[model samples]
Target chain A: MSEAFSGPVAGHVPVLRLGDVLMVTLQGDLHDSTAQQLQQDLAETITHSGATGVIIDISGVEIVDSFLGRVLAEIAAQASLLAARTVVVGMRPAVAITLVELGLTLPGLRTALSTEVAMDLLTQGAPRVGVRRESP
Target chain B: MPEHTAEETHGSPTHEVRDFLRRRREQIAQRWADEPLFRSVFTVSRDEAVEAGKAVVDALAEVADAGRVDDPDAAGFSGVREQLARMGVARGRAGLTAAQVSSELATLRQPVENLLLSDIGEAPAEHVRACATTLTVLMGTLRVVVMQTALSEGEALIDRQRLQLLEVATPVIKLWDGIVAVPLIGTLDSARSQVVMETLLQSIVEQQARFAILDITGVPTVDTLVAQHLMKTVAAARLMGAECIVSGIRPAIAQTIVHLGLDLGTVITRAGLADALKYALHQLGADIVGPTANGTGHR
Candidate 1:
């Protein structure tokens, strides 16, 4: 799982393509420019590769300011436009808390516990009701 | 001659008051032992009251010697301020208000004044008046210190109990695998809602639960602030990769939410904790079917 993303590094953040799905793992030191470039590269890859899903693993990120939160939300928005479902996986509890505190709930963004669950949600043609999304 | 030179160095009535207190410590303490402040606090024994009285007298003398007779927060009064505050609290517990305790402290100056005036023939009359005035000023400062510390002590105690209440009220329970619930009881204030959100998020990570349920059936009301807080908590859970379900929105609360024009868009809601747990189990692919004929079934 640690070496899941081996092929095709895009900018500082590695964007790996596995089968029909694209994997992008974000690190803790993801700067403003690095995230922007990853967004651009991810959008291009999704279109070119015709990937059905984009799974972004953000477990390593400890601090997420409003800028990163907005960028993540935008990335998901872009992925959906490219006809690929984006599932943000492995968001740390602290990062979630900071994003919420900053009033950035990233509305309409899908989240999964891990890359395995993300793959399950994307690959399995189960009823979308199982993956419930609610805003309180 | 050395003592005279030392007294002259101060060049004020503070030194005279300090010496007078030290010289007449025993008599002053003996008199103050009967005052309400000392008498109420040292109820077990008269000797104990006298001993406590002597300590206060010594602190006052030190303050006067340091030329800070008018400053209640002088380093010399540090040891006795907390003790006096506690004594004031005891007086409060005994049904005497702070004003009464201060008046009791005011009565303390008379005995010291008598001791000072008794030797007025030896010292000049003007000098005796100066020492008496200094004593009044010192006692006034003591009153302010007593009021300040006692009020703060009461506030700190209330703050602590409130924190403990919050901890006891919010309990995050693990309902099943990949599911956690916080059964919140009582009204949801802004401060309390903050605690609920933090506790739920932490429990989700620790249990690695994919589903989080917030059961607010025990909550009495749903005002705008509380509804807003609930909204924030739900959003936070989603960001952390856990699906949060808010359950137990009673009929009245549901109506109130709509009337207040509050929007809980995209967040899941259920009728009660049972329903919330059922939804979570279903999402986890668990069926709640009855047994066929063995008279056995999993709930």
Candidate 2:
């Protein structure tokens, strides 16, 4: 259970494979080089595990610059190329406001509130279809 | 006349300078009245000008008699300054400029100097110089008092304008029953940010809004500081039990965010106000079913 937490102090990104989903939780401040390395690691993990979905939890990261934003988008783009959907979860309200303010929409990147929501979204067949009413 | 007590000798100038001006007070008043600038600038009747002139000459005589010339800070100047300040306020109310007030003070110097130098002929040279210096110092102090009062009035005006700008900057509008939106425009400095947060939270509690949409479509640029302010607004709304959705994420801003590599974790964002409203409605379990979709209205 906690084995996933134990890894090299630096240059370490925890990637857990749960069924067909690859869960990656980003913690601490990620340097430009560290973010680039994680992009590579996520792509490699997706290929080897044959995961159909990627959930990135970024609740711990307090700051996101343009480099980090690009890396996250790149990871999503890479996952999609491998036939996997990327759902970034646990983004703090501040981080979202900042990212949009910086002018990066992370096109094609799907977002969910929490890991459970992301998992549920992935399990569902289409974009969360439920009781929807029409405004007359 | 009351007895000339010892206190008069100590309390008033009672010096040669005081007697010189008092004996010729009418003459100095006449000279001041004859000055064209005083008559034209004051815009008062001939009698009013002479009355004002007499009062000023009398005030100077009072100070000179007090023997307070050696120390301008002496209590004697308080009475002098108060009289001048009264005159200054009246002049200000009459729409007089600072230049006119100062020139009026300067004009008094000539009449007094002429009286002291000529009327008190054969007086010691040093005594004459002392009287002249005392008059100059007193008049200079009066000029300062008048300007200070005017400056304070100007500052009060500026303070009012700044508050008005703050009120105009943050406007939280109610869009629907449970939805309120703050359309922020212009720079988001710390002062404006504080206003934005306070107004949004108050609106949240007052309207009991379940959803708050902060639209920054008019914000020229999104920097780290601006981002921090938005985060604070959202957190405050959440504390009030309202969900905040940021909208107006233009393409350029989107590119900048990704390029900056800022991670906006799970806070929901929409590209425009309409989308954010739609999402808010959906969350509220209400949907806008367009009339055109069913083709019922067209028929």
Which residue runs does candidate 1 get wrong by more than 4 Å?
A: A1-11, A47-49, A125-136, B1-11, B296-299
- Displacement of the residue A106 alpha carbon in candidate 2, Å: 27
True contacts kept of each: 0.60, 0.05
State the weakest 10-residue window (summed lDDT) of model 1 chain B: B2-11
* lDDT tens digits by residue: candidate 2, A24-130: 88888876666778899989998999999998888688888888888888898988899999987766545654665576656567765557657867877465423
Per-residue alpha-carbon lDDT of candidate 1 for residues A1-136, written as tens digits (9 for 90 to 100): 1344432352468789998899988876666777898899999999899998899999888888888888888998999898888889888877877787788888878887778778888887452334323311
TM-score of each: 0.88, 0.52
